[model samples]
Target: MVSVSASLAIAATLPARAEDPPPQLTGDWGGWRTELANRGIEFQIGYTEEAAGNASGGQHNYVRAAGQLVLGSTLDLQKLFGVSGATMQITLTNRNGRNLSDDAGLNTLQQVQEVYGRGNIWRLTQFWYEQKAFDGAVALKFGRVTLGEDFAAFSCNFQNLTFCGSTPGNLAGNYWFNWPLSQWGARLKVKSGQVYVQAGAYQVSPRNSDPDRGFYLGWEQTSGALLPVEFGWTPTVGGLPGKYTATLWYDTSHANDVLRNRQGLPLAVYGGDPRREQGRYGVSFQFQQQLTRPDVADPVRGLSAFLNITQTDRRTSQTDNQIAFGLFYTGWLDSRPRDVMAIAIGRTQVNGRYAENQALANFNARGFLQRPEAEYAIEAYYNLNLHSGLDIRPNIQFIRHPGGITNAKDVLVLGVKAIVNL
Candidate 1:
């Protein structure tokens, strides 16, 4: 997650120079970008490309590329029309490409590329209106929104999905969709000096992910509501800042039991009768801290670490729990202030009930077998900032167990990601 204070510090160091042009691929539209910002309308456009392949240990070796285009705009009500404390944001996204996970037959739970999702489709990602009141202590937002954008907001500096976005959303994807797939939702937040509380209610519907229904806003087949609450603390340690957040989410929807039958026995052994349950829930904790302060000459360079953990109801979740931690260093070399290096490790634990079911199925179908358990992944990358608006990251990942299945061999993956601001 990017801290507000850290963003401010970076901005403070980049004072505009009359002689230098704006740092954008489009060259600030010949100063039009600044003119529009002054008038309260800010537009943004970007594209990201990821190419990945499994070099060893998967079912097959294949290379694939995924691409995403994002277009967005933000309008400030106060500056545009003299309306106080209100703003509106709109974003559109398009994704195209084949997924490496499926292509290589490496059943890794977390995706290899953060940009690969519901591929080859266009969708309205975000359209929200926010208003602030009570001297900016309270805020309210509503409309098509993704819960991850506000709560448990994690950075996407790494290529792996495990280290990107909200942990709960990554673990409980069936119910909690992350970015590029939003639903009707609203959020309210209240903040004080160093602490804050926030809550949200969102529509839960699987149909929202269907590309054919990309623009569908109807409540048809709506299962139930997804409600979330979070509390956060921001503190300064040794003059450096940190943020800690805890979140709880409950989906008041009917969920099918993963392993149980109507008689509460293993579904595979009980005539394949499925059992259904109401409500699904999860919890997550996230922490990001600046470990080393940057020197006065390079306010944008520093060392930071992050940890995220999430647990979901085992009976209803495919992956019951996930934990990830990582460290990142910016500007390790004074000459390359825009460069960053990071390493992260993540583990996804299979649900015990699901494992038992798999074991039973294997025994019945194959006569002898091992059950699924957990998968572990570790990744490291160096982000080379080619320019203010361009970045290229080369990364590698090792997977101890590709699919949580005991027989699955370890896998090694190599990839590169490129992001451009247009």
Candidate 2:
């Protein structure tokens, strides 16, 4: 919904300056905005909305709309209080409306309307303090935080859940919390030339994502913790920017096996409770590069590609793995330098063990359950940047084997997304 993670990630890599900020719909506000900037305070507001409807397939056809509004501000303590290399950020988000996948009956593994979920309510998205050292090569952040904001973070520029945000959070979401959710945690990032290493430990409590706990800052009902480490390379290859990263993560919390009983037999057949596991582990990779640039000087006008892969522990995960890739062309036409056209394909694979359990359950129940394999999604969109602070994107999606069922009808969906920098 709101991109507090993306903002924090970018802030970690760059130092705040005592200068005018980016343009917004309300420019300057006379001299007040300039006065605030001089005092190291800057405010930002963003709104995103998605509307989608299924044209074919699914259990029924329906249309739904969802939206999010984010309000945030950053304070540079170095300029405000003479505390060098220190900054603070606070953000609040409000999300509302329904999900197309559920309302439209497109029972796919991922949602076509990515902006929905995490309940329709208000949330304290971010509240963190960061300090940079060694000339911006090292950054340490703590307080209310999310692991996805720093490690395995990806741009949420797409409308499909399969192609948006953090891949690990999508696959292993039982433990990994993404944006609009915060937990007690800390993260450290160290950069050396083109290579960087980052690590974080975050609270693994389910309360963080609870709708009622949006403003609850206490550590009550806490589980264990989540630890993640990442290694990355950001290079200018052939004068084109590229980023490659690998992440390894573990959760100390205990989770139940998806399929097995306490005796290690299929719980579906045995009619017993699933076995409890002590820990869970996962790995993920991200690759993004600007493949072609018509104008060497204009970095924004180019063809960029991205690939994401994530694998979770088989013992506790149903959707254990996912692979997604996409390409977006910016300024393909000289007349529309800010326009973008993009297409993406993604597959979410059901864990084989889970599938076996499902088969056993189906056999026991006389084929009441659907045996799943993998769900695939294809999405394409054209983004019209009508002005500096507004963009409208029209998109289409094709979902194959919804819920990974071979007999299920493929779904076709149409959608539109609007974004405003308020």
Candidate 3:
């Protein structure tokens, strides 16, 4: 799908370079002299597979593959009129999930059932348009954009084994929650000097195809020392840090209610028939800092740390109330060149008493989701600039449900991974 908005084209007339014109004077636009064209395209493909053996919980096997294509036409930096840039993107994915009653790779496979919407394939994950930023500073965007969907975690699933769920219980998460999140709205971006902000809203109609009004609001900013946002595309405890700065953000979501009947009786949850309305409301926060000691001219001398906290409550009888906490850090063994190491640890707790689908959320690197019950993860990754498309990562992940708690032998997962970024 392509969306085009035409406006005033850039002006094309220039005087001599004598001393410079007024500061507020807009630059020249048009003509072959200052025209800019992007005419660039890119594509990425990923595939992964995993299987378990032995007496742990039921053996599990999974496979996921995705591909993305992006197209962008060039634009003139000097032209000020009739939209200067245009971009379109497309994605597709297929994931197979199942738990085996016996050993998966050991011998013959027995009973294995698909989990949730496992067999379902998303032929098109995303389709959107991106304009040349209004200014080199504010990147105004709109359309059906993915929300805190947890994509980062989806990427590290197999290709790289070191990192656990960046968006654990999110839509693309492994254990419980699974769903590609989307928002229909407008987003504005502005930046000046070393400071910038991203804020946007999503509209939700009560029914699936109905026209209910819903909104998504988020704000993030960065300075010489701080980088903070209400909700990032990916969920993580690793906040952006600076030698001397602070970053912070807050956000909220309310789903549209299309379940009210004409007499105000509850009917269906998503359609616009005489229905009752309900929605999901939640907020999130993040903080980061770079610890420096005395006279250190370089940022390599300081350690950085951050924390994230979030909560959700839906006015439905199904599932409600969720909380999560995460901590992360980036500190070098010493102040020597680009030698850096990072660690991220996280814990997620859902209302264990509920029998609803609350335990289905997941957390992935792309964003934060509820994830499985009693889930904790610890990971370490080291950057290897010399080893092209490679990273050294070691990680430990624990997962379990109410059933796995009493057995003591619970669920334990450990692995080492290498990343090849093509």
Query: Best-fitting candidate, measured by lDDT?
Result: 2
Which is superior by lDDT, 1 or 2? 2
Q: What is the lDDT of residue 76 in candidate 3?
A: 28
| Descending-TM-score candidate ranking | 2, 1, 3
- Pairs of colliding residues, candidate 1: none
Whichever of 1 and 2 has more TM-score, that candidate is 2
- Please, what is the whole-model Cα lDDT of each candidate in the order they appear? 0.80, 0.82, 0.31
Stretches of candidate 1 exceeding 4 Å from the true structure:
1-23
lDDT of 1 at 17: 16
Q: For model 1, how does the per-residue alpha-carbon lDDT over 1-422 read when each residue is reduced to its tens digit?
A: 11111121232122111112224567678889889988988776778899999999767899999988878788889999998999888888888998889888888878887788854788888888999998889999999987787777776667788887678888798889887888999999999998999999999998888866667677888999999999999888786777899999999999989999878888867756678888999899988788886686664578888889999998799889999988888888889887888899999888888888888888899898668888888999988888877778899988887678767888898999887766
Expressed as tens digits, the lDDT of each residue in 308-400 for candidate 3 is: 443333332122222233222223444333333455554444334322222222222234433223333344444332232223344333433
Winning candidate number (TM-score): 2
**Residue-wise lDDT of candidate 2 within 1-422, one digit each (tens)?**
32632321121112112132433666678888779978999887888899999999887889999999888898999989999999998888889998889876788998898888887888888899999999989999998875666787777777889988778888887678887888889989899999999998899888888976678798777879899999999899888778899999989988999988899888998868889999999999998887787987776687888889999999999999999988888887989887888899999999988998988888788957668999999999988878766778899999999988889999999999887775
TM-scores for all predictions: 0.94, 0.95, 0.49
lDDT (Cα) of model 2: 0.82
